[model samples]
Target: MTSSTPLRIGVMGAHSTGKSLLMRRIEMELHGQGIPVARTGNLGRRAALVPLPKMQHHTLASTTWVIATGIADEIAAWARLEKGPVQVVLADRACWDALAYFRAALEWRQQTAPRAEREALHQLAHAHGRTYDLLLATVLDPDVPVESKHDYDPRYRTLVDRHTHDFLREENIRHVRVTSDPASQELAIEHALQLCMTEAPA
Candidate 1:
């Protein structure tokens, strides 16, 4: 809570869509390109306490916890920069990104979140999302194949990927969809840095 929130750019996508890859490269790209920006390490994977499917009866609770944790972490990161020279906060994942995964979890449970419950929770997420100036959404490349993660089954990754793509469009959140190509991750990082600088204060 300060006079101005740090310029936030959140990277979003499914498990293997290079969110972390971009997260790692953003700080370097900014510095290498001589763009002064502070960055937050990826908490998207680490913040999961009670996972979606595992929370069966308390799906809403788990969703709230995970999403809240994400926003809280982002805010904390921003606060850490108050006295520093950094003005832009490049975030790997955010509450909006959490919303995408939460939806995918709902589907995995074979149960729909009651409209009222879903709306209330998502409204909170959207409120937190207001701090973000840019959202870079990466898509899973068909040719690349989903990289294996111990926690993510191939089917679940696909499901989460579909929902993540749909949520951004359905919610009308302003975002740019970046495609990971057969060649390398550098393209994605360069593309993200380009988007971040669009409105970056620093």
Candidate 2:
């Protein structure tokens, strides 16, 4: 890829599934290969769109959702601007899944709202899916416990995971499933790198 058109690679999985760690590792590996890389987390802690009231109340979930969505929008804008081949862009979150999860959350909150809100959330979810270049599914071993203190409902977690996989399959996006093993993590990074390299312009 040229300096202007970076290959975007996304790493997605459940919270505390080593998504951040894997992203760091990928950066290191790409650097070793002399590849220029730009990396960002799926969700940022301090996104600007977070309402001041929500920040004052320490609304972790809302803040996270806003950050994640912001990153997606930002990346999509960047891709549109850089029309030539460029370095690699590795994102630690999957934008499409985040949109879906947020849509689910919004619908739950507006359970009593008019039908228009429901339709809007659905439209938003569909729009978000078209933003990403690829979706990486970071699979946690079923034995691993969900340890994040975040209040994501257990049922919601299950639903998002299933939906994420289904979305990737439907989009025909290249995905690498990283197991809990150390070797598997390395392999996953390698697989992602290969995908990035292949997509790069000759």
Candidate 3:
């Protein structure tokens, strides 16, 4: 591992949560401060392009691919500094998010992943998490209405939310939890801005 790395803020949660919006707010704040920011997102869509199973059909291979690709994207964002002056990275879906979806899918099917495979992937996510400068996870509020176009399964979405927080607790990872409340959203954005402004390269 290098002695230095770019500042990273990762957001994770179930689908329909405001993960993207939160990242966007932080990105805009960083931009206003004149910091170069790179954001990595749409991993689910990108994974589907590879014909990998996703959402309720998530498999070990697809989950692994998502996590690895997310890690690679963050590294690439940091590498951008070598070419220019990129200072911060916003990851819309942190590495562990895929695992949460995968576990939720298995439970939805009343199946369990092999212990070894689960352990290995958990370690992979945990290891990558150590590199994050800040992590914000959204809490799912069932009462919040999602857009009509999204055909998200309510049960599965809830399971993903539960598992996301479970993974965080299991790994003892520290993070800020954001809810649908406007106050929580503002706090998350403020936290991100403070982190970037304080830690960005001088």
- TM for every model, in the order presented, reads 0.80, 0.64, 0.95
- Kindly report which residue pairs in candidate 3 clash with one another: none
* Higher-lDDT candidate of 1 and 2: 1
* TM-score-better candidate, 1 vs 3: 3
Q: What is the per-residue lDDT of model 1 for residues 1-202, given as tens digits with 9 covering 90 to 100?
A: 4455567778877777777777767777777776657666545445443344332233677667767777777777767745655556777776776667777777766778789988988898888786677777888775675535545556666777788889888888887677786344566566667766675554
| Alpha-carbon local distance difference test for all models | 0.69, 0.58, 0.89
Q: How well does model 3 score by local distance difference test?
A: 0.89
* Per-prediction tally of clashes: 0, 4, 0
What lDDT does model 2 reach?
0.58
Whose TM-score is greatest here? 3
Error of 3 at 181 (Å): 0.3
What are the RMSD figures for all models against the true structure? 3.3, 5.6, 1.8
lDDT, candidate 2, 1-202, per-residue tens: 2345566677666556678888898888887877766676634454434333221232325534554465665456345435543367777675554544443344434433347654554455446545455556776455777656865455555545555566567756666777678888888877777876677443
Q: Deviation in angstroms for 158 in model 3?
A: 0.4
Pairing residues by index, what is the TM-score of model 2? 0.64
